[model samples]
Target: MILKCVAIDDEPLALELLSKFISQTAFLKLEGRFSNAIEALSFLNQNEVQLIFMDIQMPDLSGMELARILDGKKNNDKTRIIFCTAYNQFAIEGYKVEALDYLLKPYSYEDFLAAATKAYQYFDRIHNTPVAKSAEPTATQEFIFLKVEYQLVKVMLKDITHVEAYKDYVKVHLKSKANPLLSLTSMKNMEELLPSEKFMRVHRSFIVALDHIDSVAKNVIQIGDHQIAVGENYKEQFLEFLSKWMS
Candidate 1:
């Protein structure tokens, strides 16, 4: 999902940095850049924007005042703000206006990406769009992106054999690869992201793709060369599914 956004900062260099950061992010699109809040307010009146990266301190109109004005506009609730400034003192004030996030000046690209990802998640929930995307999906070609190291690796849903929990991450075992894809995300998150109709959590540490199961033996599930044990807490549900499968 691409979020239409603008940058508002009095300093030319700051606006440049925000513009550069937005360009680097995959999900963000730069709609406009303003050196002051007044011009930005005027432009905002004519255009619809999903987000704003604004400076707190400015001449004539301040970012906080603009946020309040935006809060009053009709059908403007979709637009969110992330304040960028040098002073950390106004952090509370920024949130009081209900800004989505606050970025202190000299923030790195990593920090900016984190805030943008948060915004993406918010939009994704309300819009019912997946944060991860591949090529146009058919009935059977659905896919998702996993953060592997510094890259977002796309994995087709049909290729996922099973998911295993690492200490702080999840290992996505795929049919097309010899090794599992390691991502720095929790198992709980993986469970939520995958469609419930296609993937089932059979253990506290394992989520197996329903179509990939080779056979079920007692409390164990066999998928290719791997044998996964069903936890006691999940055994009943697994059995229920097994009954339905056999019937």
Candidate 2:
């Protein structure tokens, strides 16, 4: 699915850079660009955009204030945000507004691509789009290719102990490796890609291998060293699954 996006930055150079980057991305369509938040706010009020690449600090109105305004709007719930700023101090604030990613200024193309990919995955999940068709495994398929760093690493589904959500990315913990495979994707995407019988989303931030779980205690599923809490929303289904093991 193509995401309609806009860039809001006070700096001409920054706006130009963002416009260029958005143009290069395959799934992103540049709807508009603004040098200040005021014009962007007016544009957003009239038009519908799925994503916004905005600078936090702007003259007259800051991006944070713009986000607050957008958050209050009923029609802007689907508008995802990616904050592009020079200061890393605004990272926490960006999270408060449910931003898809935070691009630290002077970032490289790889960093930008990663953030863009995360946004793509976010939209793909919400819209139920099959953008990553090649990554999807068939019923008989045992492994999947994950884009890690620039390489498509082949990983066996059975080897994954659990999936951990880290901001815009997901860390796939493998039993065969000491380090988990960090990919620029969301937990929702991972949960949808995995087989329902073998893997289950036990928490908003976690998906665990049901067969790999060592025990269940205090609403937590233990898989090796990892302790994943069962979210309140998913607890009923999880408890029903546990009923099969009761004596």
Candidate 3:
């Protein structure tokens, strides 16, 4: 799926470079380019672009302020934003507004591709996958059908040991299978499908099935043959689960 995107930057050279990067990417299509945020916002009001490459600082309207406005809009289309700025101070703030990714100024084509690839994977799942509708987990729902290539493979929730993020896809580890089931979806998608009561995200790249945990030591969880490290961001929640288990 091609993502229709727009770029907004006050710098003529930066805007041209960003547009060039967008054009170099196979899955991204540059729909518009604006030197200021006001014109970009006005164009966005009428256009349905899937992704935006924006500068955080601009005259009249800042990218952050325009993002806030876009968030409040009643339109059905949700456009993901990637903020490009010289200042690194806005990194945390950019994520707070739910920007897809932040690019530091003078970024390489490789860095640009990484951020754009993330957007492509997100849109690919939204437009091409059925997991959004059929994979919603419930208390009694014990199984889910995962799209693998052209066929839907039925996987029992009880058999799941953990879900591992494999680049753009996720590996659904199961007790019954010799190898994990590879699905063309994000870790976020898998987390949404698995019952939260039974599964917990121990790390950004690993979600462990509470029932299948073999051991825990030094912030690492052992499930079967795999040892998954607990990320610092997730440590508090994982420890809370442990405290409950011990109690």
Candidate 4:
């Protein structure tokens, strides 16, 4: 399916480059391009854009500001957003807006592809499902909210990198954090919480997020900067996941 897309940026070259990229891309269908948020807002009011390539800074309005306005509106399920910016300061704001991905300035086609592919997959996950789950899904379903020392935390199956079995307690590693925040839990209890589609108990010591993986080589799996070892018994399942997804 073609993604109905829009680009909102004041810079002419930025707009040109995005349009140029979208023209070459097979899946993205550009519905509109606006120089500023005013024009983009008007377009958004009337049209249904499934994917947005947005800039954070502009003359009269900012992308973050625009996203805030969009956040208040009701929209269809398949819509996705990717923030385009040179500044790293806006990353937190982008996350607050629930952007699918953030693109640093002068992004290459490969970077664009990575972001776009994620958006497409997200759209598929949302629309292809028989029943749509809430963005902030229920607490009672499967995930646990655990207290580590004094702080209580909510752990989602999708964000988990791995759960390390250490004697009686297991360490939970989740996504979107600068460092992994470990909580006291058990492998047996946590395993039951994970969605079968997104996670795999690859080893007795490790359970991995299948989508967050960066690469797999021989006997190890790379999730972003960290490397997790694949046990002897789990090598086959690990290899199959890598083989199916890796180009």
In model 3, the worst 10-residue window by lDDT is: 136-145
Pick by lDDT: which candidate is best? 1
Overall local distance difference test of candidate 4: 0.75
RMSD of each: 7.2, 9.0, 8.1, 15.3
- For model 4, the superposed segments whose C-alpha errors exceed 4 Å read 132-247
lDDT of 2 at 89: 100
lDDT of 3 by residue, 1-247 (tens): 5789999999999999999988867677999999999999889888899999999989999999988888787752458999999999999889878898999998877567657766765665556555455766322455665666644566787999999999977899999888998878778767766668889998889999999999899999998889999999999999999999889
> Candidate 1, residue 110: CA error in Å?
1.0
Candidate 3 TM-score versus the reference: 0.56
lDDT of 4 by residue, 1-247 (tens): 6789999888999999988777666677999999999899888888888999989999788888888888878763456679999999989989898898999998876567557756755665555555555565433232444435444455565667766777755677777566566655556545655556678888888888788778777678788777888888978877787777766
The lDDT of model 1 is 0.86
TM-score against native, each model:
0.59, 0.56, 0.56, 0.57
What is the Cα root-mean-square deviation between model 4 and the actual structure?
A: 15.3
| Per-model lDDT | 0.86, 0.83, 0.83, 0.75
TM-score of 4: 0.57
- The lowest-lDDT stretch of 10 consecutive residues in candidate 1 is 134-143
- Error (Å) of candidate 3 at residue 90 is 0.7
Clashes of 2: 0
